[model samples]
Target: MDGLQAYGAGKAGGAFDPVTFFQQPHAILRIINWLFSVVIFGCIANEGYINRPTEEQEYCIFNQNANACNYAVFMGCVCFLCCSGLLALDVRFPQISGVKDRKKAVLADLGVSAFWAFMWFVGFCFLANQWQASKPEDNPLKEGGDAARAAITFSFFSIFSWGAQSFLAFQRYKLGADTAIFGDYADPGQEADQGPYSAFPGETVESPPAGGVDGTAGSPVGYQRQEY
Candidate 1:
């Protein structure tokens, strides 16, 4: 079966194919997420701070709100790490022998991806608002403005990418759930050997008495002999 159809099936110990792995929709989204994270955090870390000749220490570029810059950086860094870990897990997913484990992994991916998507939405809004409120005097040379815009733009993109990841993970979860439900049903062919009371094949059945209930030879129950 194709890899997408085989998702969550937990068919283990298959040969690893790098080309196919990279070509998967899931893998492509993850790579996009990873790159977006790098862009967000890299921009903030490199150019989020600016200083004037009169200032002794660097101040954040987004209206001098350290919290805004910190929040973006934190989210970006954590997302970067999560994408990396998930990519590694994806590489090893085919080797997992347990369906439950694969299900758990997919569920985790769903939850984490959804949560990050929301967070990136918040980050985008927060950064954009702060950038708009920034005073021109705060950045005399207009330094890091492009970086700020890049961070905001990529944060916006990350929301959709992560959301897409969540959607894909949910699909995998559903596939696994369906597989588990169908697997629990006894096969029709296999049920032929199981009797109504679940009696197994070759089981001995008790036989009734050969004669009447009274053990009389050729005598019926209602015909009792009279004393003559």
Candidate 2:
């Protein structure tokens, strides 16, 4: 019976669920999904299934097909390799009283992540473009327009991945927003409950019982001050 009111429909304290709030971070979910989808897309593009067998078939799923899979693997490798650098940034800097320290940490990590992202972008960009520009006669996998288009598309996803990860890195690692993810940290009502509800820390809350010193009805906590 008592538990019913504790969790019942009310605006005071029942709505906020702390467990679910801290356990989940939505930003991480979206980027991982995007990375996986792009990888699979790369693999299926050219039909290079297992081994690069110069065949004249269209439905080879288990052989070296030299299709989208080859390039997808290539793109996935590069993107994750760069993403790995973000681990360093994800570490936190302890709070200092006067001078700020967290922001400095983020700036430091940003420098490292940006470097890795740039290197990965350059290597992937050059190779992908070259492969895209190659004539089909040289390699039956991708050539001319489709090759270039696919390479460019993959590059776009790669850049997006880096940028997305980089931006999220600032909030969690550098900005110290991660500490406040669950919110204020102090007691939720401690700030606003300063007047009647909370007198001062260690201060007594003395009040007469039901019919007070003035013998009048009172509030829930049993109190009645002189009216006149």
- Each model's backbone clash number: 0, 16
| Predicted model with the maximum TM-score | 1
Model 2 CA deviation exceeding 4 Å by range: 1-26, 33-75, 81-109, 140-151, 171-228
Q: lDDT tens string, model 1, 79-105?
A: 899999999999988987766677788
TM-score of 2: 0.37
TM-score against native, each model = 0.80, 0.37
Per-residue lDDT tens digits for candidate 2, residues 1-228, read: 111211111122234444543243423533453464355345445433322257544432322234434545565565455444433223212212211344455565556546545644664565455554544454444333443344446555555555555565555543344333433367657555553545668564544468555555564354445698
Worst 10 residues of 1 by lDDT: 1-10
Q: Rate the local accuracy (lDDT) of all candidates.
A: 0.86, 0.44
